[model samples]
Target: WQLFTKPLPQPQSKSQNRQGGEQIVLLGLAAMAGALILAIYASGATALYNYSYKAGLMLLSLITLALLYWSLERLVRSPWGRILKAIREDEQVAKALGKNVFWYKLQALMLGGAIAGIAGAFYAWNLTTVYPSNFEPIITFNSWTIVVLGGAGNNAGTILGAIIFWAYNSITRFVLPTEIIKDASLGAFRIMSIGLILMVLMIWRPQGILGKKEELTLGQ
Candidate 1:
């Protein structure tokens, strides 16, 4: 929908608009085909009951992480990445410089969405099931925490942030006085601790552990 509306040139006539719509449809179909292929391959591999799913999952995850990291690193170091940074800092300035801000933004959104979809697919494979309840609003918040803790716009930082967040959760689960507090209350306390830690981090270093202060727009 964003591709159809935001990035493309405004069509002056009905025929031109139809053509644009057709392009989006074609792209969507291609994406779906790729997804189908991946699904089939994963299903076949995991279907073998004797096969170790954990080993396969771990190997696949490492490969995916490497590819994603390499791709993002290369992109961010290119000239196009400078434009993206400019757009993020000031869209109006990017527009004034004759850059297609809308198109760049749309591209960023599409890239992010695609990566997220891949991650979701992997998550489903790990769980061996896909259910509506699997997705919750807290998932988004947790992602935000990781991003903020790691340092915005820094891929390595984001990865480290996620590790730290999960490590904290694991530690708390085992270290907390579960006998004193009910299981439900303990869960709430764990969440509150994370929130408190985030608040402290925000106050001390709004740019995150690895982030440069100049790169942040906190005061602005």
Candidate 2:
């Protein structure tokens, strides 16, 4: 992990996750579902919006996408973000400083839920019509790798990480397992290969390609 300068999962805070309760998860799932529904609905609405007002549906889609970005910004920059940061540093100190820690945590979670919902809306509109089948577990894990490649705490790093991750994935998928090596379902092999890469990255260089050692600390 030190070799890469990325932050591996450390014994962070139980409250970090405790703050995100079942409600948030349920709402998030529901939002994804709703996005699927809306996408199907858009199959009809698209023509209507275009016929009735020309580009109206597409415009709405653009607005929805804008809202998604806005929501992410809000989640990252709002008061809740501060609270989460505070809690991350020292919950006891934050409470001693007279912060309504629980409320801030709750708001952080609900904001996450809403942001996911907005993302679903965009996915439904822009991507292949949203469906549960479309959301695979690999999507989540892939995101993790991207986060590592970029810089754990840096948005710019995350973007770069995404690019690097996809490129690496494509290259490995093509290069590994030549005709002689034989194919045994990329599903399992790729999983192991990626996991190995992550494990090696974690052990050797956890700070990420561009992140600083100070920025990648597990805790005090």
- Model 1 residue pairs with clashes: none
Q: All models: lDDT?
A: 0.62, 0.54
Error of 1 at 98 (Å): 1.3
Using lDDT as the measure, the top candidate is 1
Tell me the tens digit of each residue's lDDT in model 1 across 1-220: 5654454344354332212111222222222223333443455567777345545665666677667767777877887777777665655556678877667656666776677777777777766888999778876667777767877567766666766776686667766677777777877888898899899999999878776677565113
What is the alpha-carbon lDDT of model 1 when measured against the actual structure?
A: 0.62
Could you list the CA RMSD of all candidates, in the order they appear?
A: 9.9, 10.4
Specify the highest-TM-score model's number: 1
- The lowest-lDDT stretch of 10 consecutive residues in candidate 2 is 17-26
What is the lDDT, from 0 to 100, of the residue 175 in candidate 2?
70
